[model samples]
Target chain A: MDSQVTRREVLKKGLIGAAGLTVLPSVIAACSTSSATTAPTAAAATQAPAATPTPNANILTGKLTLGNNHSDASDLKGVNAINDAFKALTTLAVTTNTVDHNTFQDQINNYLGATPDDVFFWFSGYRMRFFADKGLATAIDDTWAKVSSNFTAGFANAVVGNDKKVYGIPVDYYPWCVFYRKTLFADKKYTIPATWDDLITLCKKMQTDGLTPIAFSDKDGWPAMGTFDILNLRMNGYDFHVGLMTGAQKWTDPKVTAVFQKWATLIPFYTHGYAGLTWQQACDTLVRKTAGLFFLGLFMTGEVATVDATASADIDFFPFPFMGNSFDAEQALDAPIDIAMISAKSPNLAADLVNAKAYMEFWAKGSTQLLMYQANNGFIPTASDADTTKFDVLTQKAVQIVSKAQKITQFLDRDTRPDFAGANAMQSFLLNFLNAPTQDLAKLQASIQAFWDALPVYAGN
Target chain B: MSVTVMAGQRTAHNVARRRLSRGALYVFLTVLALIFLWPLLYAAYTSLRPYGEVVANPNGFFSTPATLNLNNYFFVWNGGNYPQFYLNTALITIPAVILTLWISSMVAFTISRFNWGFNMLVLMIFTAGNLLPPQVIIVPLYRLYNLIPVPAPLSDNGLMYDQIIGLILIHTTFQTGFCSFVLSNYMKTLSKELVEAAMIDGAGVFTIYARVIMPLVRPALAALGTLLFVWIYNDFFWSVMLFKSGDKRPITAALNNLQGTFFTDPTVVAAGSLMAAIPTIVLYLILQRYFISGLTLGSAKG
Candidate 1:
């Protein structure tokens, strides 16, 4: 009787109640309103077991709102095409918002309400863990399986939740590779280097030839993070990248130390004014033909377009030439972008989510892909055979490299273990610190390693 | 002939002096205007060009006139979820200004006129409230807001927890401390002759303040209102703390999203920034004449 009374007390206290009452009203209101507006379709509700099985009949409906990351109005086709298609498929509204990834959570908190919009585009890895733990996500596993095989996945087996549920989907995926000005390389009369020695020699030749070997920006500490991540991929290979992110390997390990060493040696090869330069500014070094190399992804193609659209073909991107190609170049490191998801506490939970799914699926394919490529001068996320006519020679090269890669590495932001991801910002900090000859490289190394030690260890299934 | 030539030389000399003073004034004003308009000028120039151009030519001020690319504005509006942001900002700023003014003026009138025994203590408490960091209140407030349930049958679409109204309430409450302090100080200058006359006429405290003293504080009110308007717009810490949707975002929150994304389109960003700036610039233009007068009035009265 005492236990029973305790349970009742807890319920009354709303500690663990019938539902989160703050969000309950919106849920109830949306349900009643949805019921009144549209008859529930006879589609089978996905009753897949939490393990592995196909889900049926869970058609996410209503307006699926996604946060637009890094895209402006001109990049509409990528985000809104799916929104349009979702509208065509259902009598529901879907929308998207463009937002900054840096302050995304802080920005979202300002709008927290019971009836939070049905869907939002946020991050994965540690950020996603924070949301998932807080119960912000709708755990769209059942919805995922229904459309799982429809579009191919980079890492189909590894993307599932602990209970074997899939949490997010892929939008655009790529390996953060060395994007070089092809014309500069050709003009310099240099062949593509086969090994690390060849790369160093090329950098020296470029330096001697009065050209910058690489372009980097440490202003936000991100361009350096790219430098660090790429070096880590080279030093430790893809497994170590996964291990370090999951807290399986200490960040201060000799292997990790080697990664930092690589960045330190390469710093001299970077642009002269990199300390205060933004990535966009640094990218201009390549676009305007001042610098020839940048270690970034196809995403940067968007920012450098005004330099000269044709010189984009002067660019050639290649994944870090692995000393050990355990896998084919196509099977090497590729980063997959996190997909759109429905919120558990959304206003019009059922209808809104179904509508949102349709839009996201459309975003993962078609003209959106082409617009993304043409606008950025990067590779589109499509099969190799998807019309090579529109692509310039530069983007076509990127397309050929991406198509044959069997396994794409997930983004460091997403693939890193959840706890460590929160502290991953420190990696960029240490790398920037390493660039200065005055700073103690040892201290920088320890500071980042300390944060790595502090992260919680969670075992992934 | 000599007298005529001398007269003509003297007239020409006078004209040159007058023209020189006018030229000096124009030069000075032009310099001052450039100083004042530099930020907007930079933002405008930056917005017109594509990111590549700016990167290649960071110091280029006027070599080209790039069209004020509407790409960023429309992108922000449609793709960035700026519509919800505008709505949320309105919700937070409007109520915060109105209610704080009303509450502060009332508190000020009572404190200034009523000879309450602990009035000084009350004033001191309110004055000291500004010393604490707002972050101290955040955790408690979050829990408190979470615990306080919304009434039943609440609209699903309406924001109860993190909407603009909630932000308005927090800001309104926080601002009252300073508003009351300023109002009370301003009210002290209310001529003793008027108060004495009112008291002799058997006018109640409320009636005296409402009829006599309130009208006198119009300039003070205007000064306070403008300050409040700028504060709400420039705010970053709380707006992010309170509101989550991109649609409900303010200019500050939205501006932050510009450079960090994978997309490095600087042209779109510059355009969006210019768009965000337009209203504030227009507001100042509308209110500048009265604004300075209000400030001068408060300082002189004090």
Candidate 2:
């Protein structure tokens, strides 16, 4: 009886404590509300107007968001600096933007729906065609016609859509090459190979020395596309290259077979554990001096150079040498990613388009080009003013190949179905090849055939 | 007297053999545990390595001279927008956990005590809700959230952190269905005599619940909180869609930013990945005792 009475008293106290806990939240809220001002009119009134020389609400003046290293539409300048620039440029305080490489497609999707940037960075080629197809990017042909410079002319055609309408101003004419460790080659008494067979022999020598000859990450679906493009250009030529990608040519063509054969030879010479490794990991092979060469995009300069600045200087590149050319002018595998576009339905549409034009012109300047090169060394310049000499000796050779190349082709994966790039066709090609190498040559042939057969119309063959 | 002593000695030998078998069982369980835990251990181990070290020795995980560089942690904390993300996550998780415990407990109590119109139907609906694919609802929910006239301060640059409420709602609402089912089943098995006795003593329904039910469910609360914390922390998709800006983003989002097209730097990636892992690991460590006890109690027949 005494214990039961004590329990009741304890329960009564617990109930009182619970009631007090409930009202405590309200009391805190009341105190906060009494002290807080809901509006910031007083703060806004005291602030000076941001400095915008000839601030035209009409210009829709905002900083151009360029893709970083391999990121989607973000600024070349890092986020905080980009935000400040955008704020100063627009006189409307812009906060921040972010981008990622693997997840760029989704980021683009998010940007398209909610807040399409005023002047976003983008790539050139069939990659740009999608934005043009969706009517997301505006035509800047008029602006291009007015800017009378060799850079504009060189890049103008690349950004033009299939409709013959220009959608974006091309910033990068990225030319990919076979980049190798110059130190490794020199140490082995190996000169940069001139022919396909010579390259093979060099790879064999490297393998004998227990070194990987090439560093390619097929795990990153797009990087292996470089090998195919380079090989196909050598075997078939530019027309076939365009035909196969545009879905006009058959995958079972003799040209594709030759290209596939080249890849088969190259496979044994590449770094170990290539199956799920990303391109960056592949780059690590070179950075560690375990591998010799890699077929990377012309834009790879930025990527390869960023591998610890001290170590990166040791890295250099060469033109991906071919046994021969597909066309009279040398054809190489290269294209663009990060294709910026403008909205057709934007209320600030025309003004935004003008700013976009101005941004292109502004970004294309030699000073700005120098700025970009300084910021990210591997940035391939479409503009003539860009000092290609800033690159190492081997990179200069690659730039020579790029500048004088007859026809620059697109990376096959990006030029194909954007959704399906890493999903089915290319995925099957790499995985099936890697796992089932001993199965049969017929198995490889059949895999390519199956994708080509089931491909939807408008998928470039 | 000699024969009886010999028989007792044989019995003792048999008891020793049985103890040996139990020890073998433990050894077998430990081996299986190691097999399951090896990948997690490897990931944690890799996390401790610097970027350059891991890159230099991709295949050399065991042998790599990795020093415990907390730099990756510092990078993720300041660079990854963790403070803001944590605030947003807390707003969602705390309220959701409380609401789940409160509402689920009430439902369980009512179900255990009383049968009413549509009680079974409500229970079935929750079960059905849990079974439906979360992905199927994403499009509709995206549309619905967009239509909410209460101007959810869209940064108008990209989607902002305020919209994390959408993710919170989704997680809370979905988890409630699964969590409530488990909790209700446990509540049903609870001794009915205590509640009945309290009612007989003239205690009200809530009073009986307050006195009899909560103390009994402490273990359940701990088990659910730990489980949900692990799931919610590791979640990527909801965080990706719901949060956009680097400042508004979580550690996972920050890690994504490190993947540049120009260069492949897996060092920063490995470091960043390590930082993301530590919190949940710490949570797991702290709650492991409760997890073991609660699970044993819930599964075992008393």
Candidate 3:
């Protein structure tokens, strides 16, 4: 009987706890209502300033929301610093919502289609235009009109929609190039290859010297696309490459087959078991002085610097060797630009338009870009006036390379529809080629074309 | 005397054979345990080393204690918003688990105790809900969440979308099907005599449910609670899909914050993953006995 009474008391306490647990959401929800109540007053501030040409003249004061995808520790700090600068200059209170970088990229379509923040981070090139064409993003042409003189023609074209309206502010970009340790090159007395034949001879020499001629890895699937992009740009031209990505050109074009046939010849010189190694592991060979050359982005310096802080000083890169084609002089390369844009679907877009435009205009400044560049040097500023004197040797050279280019393309994924360029599609298709480089090029091209043809047509909103 | 000697020799030979077999079994179990523990051991080892050390000597299988440090943990802990994420996860998980257990147990009592015309069909329907993949209905569900207008205290947004309450509802609704099926079968094993005795003693249905059946199924409830807590706590997909604010996300979502788009510190990521797993590990340890019994409970007759 004593045990039974004790059990009853225990049961009574459990019931009370269960009831209390069920009521917790309401308490949380109630607490959050304080912030929620402020949203309406901010939204009600939408006045007769939608027609104003001068964003600064309005002195807009209200709450604006921003969605950021730079979730990395240093990157998040950079974003916060930029926001702090913006808040200091303007009366608008910015609410920045940060999501995981990859998650943000994966769910962008769903996010933009639903309720989106007033302003958000994005990539330039086809993706920026793709969303603008779908009417998911606001046209910041007025903001661009004021700041166009601050940027270059390449950046100006990058943010333009199919309808020729400017949609975003191009903030920063990093280029893909062949990186090598300058000390190794100096020790071996190796000259930077200027032509395809010279590159082959250098690889042969590196092989005889008992070094992996090219440190390569395709485990991430996207790294292989870098090789393909540079090869295509060298063999064909910028127009042809962009046409292929946009489906205006066929994959089975003899020119496309030629690029793969050329890549197959250099496959033997890649690091052994590259399919099982990540880009970082491949980058390690360069760091350890076991490899002759590494072909990757400017961001490779960031990876190497983490291991050896002084290593980046020894790192240098040359553009991929000329393939003796007419497009060689075009100096085309993949320098994907990161942009920031305002979302059209934001509920407070009307009220937030003035402040959002101010935020967009603020990003257009070279000084603003310099702030972010200092925070994370992996991304070089696109604005021409961003103090070049502040750059490290590699960044200075990278800027010169980008500015000299007659044509520029975004990375493959950023240049095409996400579904076609996603992990299941182009990533695997590229992996399939690398697994067996000697496979029939014609059949591979046909399969690539078939995959593109079968995709549902992307209908704009 | 010769016959007795032969019997003694046979017993000694049998003992030798049993000893050899036991040794082999022990060897097999040791290898299996090592294979299962390899990934966890590797992560823990990697988490202790500095990022540069791991990068320089990725294949280093053996290292001195001097090389191993908690810098990676400190780096991730200092960098990430772990405390807020933990609070967010707790808010979503505890309530969802309790609600799911309470609702399912009542449904189990009703279905198992009384003889109703639709009892078997109801159980089958509940079981079948578990078979439908959550992905199939996500698009429509997203639209539905946006369309639904909720009160202020229930949802700060004044809508079901992007609210913590929305996550709790979805978790409870989806998990109830599996919990109800398991609890009903367990409730069936309880003798009807107890219910009949309670009814005879002027006990109402609610009284019998609260006083009699709940106490009996405490073990199963504890097991289910542990499982549900972990599932809801570690949920990445629903929270990612439903919540818009970064600070509103749970701990599982916080792991992604350690990984960068262009650059990542693998040691920091490994440390973050282990840190995120601590709560679930602690809960499993506490309820392990009930969990083990819960698994085997339905296999044997009561």
Winning model by DockQ: 3
Residue B99 in candidate 3 has what lDDT?
Answer: 92
* CA-RMSD of model 3: 5.2
* Tens digit per residue, CA lDDT, model 3, A1-461: 99878766765665566566446546765666576445432333345444344545535566678989988767777888888888777645678888989888877887887777889999997788888988899998899999999898998999988888999999999999999989999999999999999999999999999999999998888899999999999999999999999999999999998989899999999999999888988998899888988889888887898987878788899988998879989999999999999999876788778788889888888888888888889878888778889998889899988888999999998898877887889898888888899998899899999999999987631
In model 3 chain A, the worst 10-residue window by lDDT is A39-48
Best by TM-score: 3
Q: What is the TM-score of chain B alone in each candidate?
A: 0.77, 0.76, 0.93
Residue-wise C-alpha lDDT for candidate 1, range B1-302, written one tens digit per residue: 99989999989998999899999999999999999999777777666665544555645434565444655567666655554445445556767899889998998888887786999999889879867789999767765654454442431233345455567777788888888888888898887789889889999877888899889888778878877876776678776665445445666776775654555565666776776665455455455544576455435443
TM-scores of the models, in the given order? Answer: 0.76, 0.79, 0.90
Best by lDDT: 3
lDDT of 1 by residue, A1-461 (tens): 99878755654554333234225434544544543233221111232212121266334432345555544445444456545555554544454545556566544543333345556665544445555655666676666666566455453443455555566654445557788877777777977765677788888988888888888876755455565666676666767776776667776678876676666777788888777777777777788766867878777776655555676556677766555545334345555555555566654555445455555555544455555655444435543223568877655666566555655555565666543443345645554565574466667667777876665654441
Whichever of 2 and 3 has more lDDT, that candidate is: 3
Interface RMSD to the true structure, each candidate: 15.0, 9.4, 5.7
lDDT of each: 0.62, 0.62, 0.84
